[model samples]
Target: MRKIAASLAVLVATTTPASAQNAVDWFGVDGLEFASPATSFRFTDLDLRDPHVFLPITIAPFPTICFDFTDNAIPTTTVSFNGNIQASYNSDSSPADGFLDASSLLWFRPLAQDGRVARVDNGGADCLAPAPTSGCAPSATAVATAYAYASFAAGTCLSSLPGTQGSPAYAPAIASPAGSCFVTAPKTFVFDNNGTPLTLIDAQIAASFNGVPATALSNGLLRGFLRESDANQIVISDPALPGGSVTLAGPAGRRQRQLFHAQRQGHAPGRERLVVLFQLQRVPGDLHRPLSAFGDHVRFTEDTR
Candidate 1:
């Protein structure tokens, strides 16, 4: 009987699928969007005209293992395509941890040529180990790591959770406007290489603003957005605003708005380019530190084309 029981245990453990092993029923937020040099708001050297970027995000109730479940039990809603799932966490009923996790799954991979969801299995480098050289290889540890990330991300977004949301030194929301803010900086660059008429291929913005003082004013009314229509809204005042301006990038997300234009640099339209800028402002007098002076501008531009 002991032998039979041991055999049964082995069978059960081995037969249990990876997805089922990690299943802990939960909810999260997600988003998807088109990212391209043409529509990129971030800085880059490429001139993206018809570039494309697929952004998907996930927000879990708690940190969780980052693995794809084989079961079809998961159901989700499209929060927004602008890659602003964190904003959805804020405006929606979900706990506001300003990041994405397994629960809050956002799909970043672009769709297939036929416009179907691009199916890439979650067997690559996750929150756990490095991506496999081959395809994704599921592991118990990897799933657990994904779960941890989900939990931490959810905690980071929750306003009610102390030391989790917008308060204090290490807090993302309190430290930097871009920290808790999740908006895809998409930009389009038009260049005139001394009237050579050349356009680059793509762009990206990697930013981190730190050491920002979180006073009382930076709290209450400082959460308001500076819309394009706002009197003090920063305009595309650059002498090189692209003539083929798009009316609006995408729908103004719940807590997000479209702000400015991107420009390429050169003696006429040189090799490098400048990315567009978006500002999250404080109500008049609500901030003690000048935003332009407070945080360090840690931004990077990449081409994903």
Candidate 2:
């Protein structure tokens, strides 16, 4: 149906793939462990990128690592590569099942310091360092070729359905940035329960994503909000992947952020939301908006289609 197609549309990009027989679904993860000593961690990822990652961390605001795996280039801060990533697919289950299944496990061998990926940045304050001489920053388009992938989607599940709940999720802080700036595109995501959208344009903040809180009057960074929605989840089952189940719970170790949808009679209440991404950035010109106190800095803007 169009609903399932729309939900699946959120996962548009395909990077680290399985095979022709299966459709590759992108996902994010945390709690990676080592296959060897404490210095080397290894697991498998049927990833959307080149089986690599940009961990959520910052060393003097230089957060990302740019070591080229193809050339075998190494950063002084990183160790030698002694890790592995192999895809083990089951005929009954696909990679998407393992990705969303709480018990199903897909892993990786971290190509970072001490054989570990960087820590999770749930608050989203971490800034990445400039690209090293050896390589460039891990980007969206380049994930198709170079490597390093994290999945984010913009979609809404039916509010009360047993399947297709909180999906197209902003899975934790496995996020990408525009250059050194954190990924600050607000409208890229839209979630709801077949409801309407609200508007909040020119929302402001401080220096960063977790900068000073957005007040009615003033703040630092400015943003544009497309929509805002309440949180809910449900067990999602896909007909394409029969015998498989998913929920798109983002990374938090054992503490999964559930996106469950409650069974309602008809429509949700007025206050209930249809949300989008929360972004932060600077604007060029100042506009005649009501919240003129800090629009030029880093505020928000929203529009509906």
* Candidate 1 off by > 4 Å: 1-51, 55-274, 277-280, 286-305
Scored by CA lDDT, what does every candidate get? 0.18, 0.19
Writing each residue's lDDT as its tens digit, candidate 2 over 97-164 gives: 21211011111122121212222111101112121111111111110101122211211101111221
Strongest candidate by lDDT:
2
Q: Could you tell me how far off, in angstroms, the CA of residue 22 lies in candidate 1 after the best superposition?
A: 57
- Specify the poorest-scoring 10-residue window by lDDT in model 1: 5-14
Q: TM-scores for all candidates?
A: 0.16, 0.18
RMSD of 1: 26.0
lDDT of 2: 0.19
Looking at model 1, residue 114 earns an lDDT score of 27
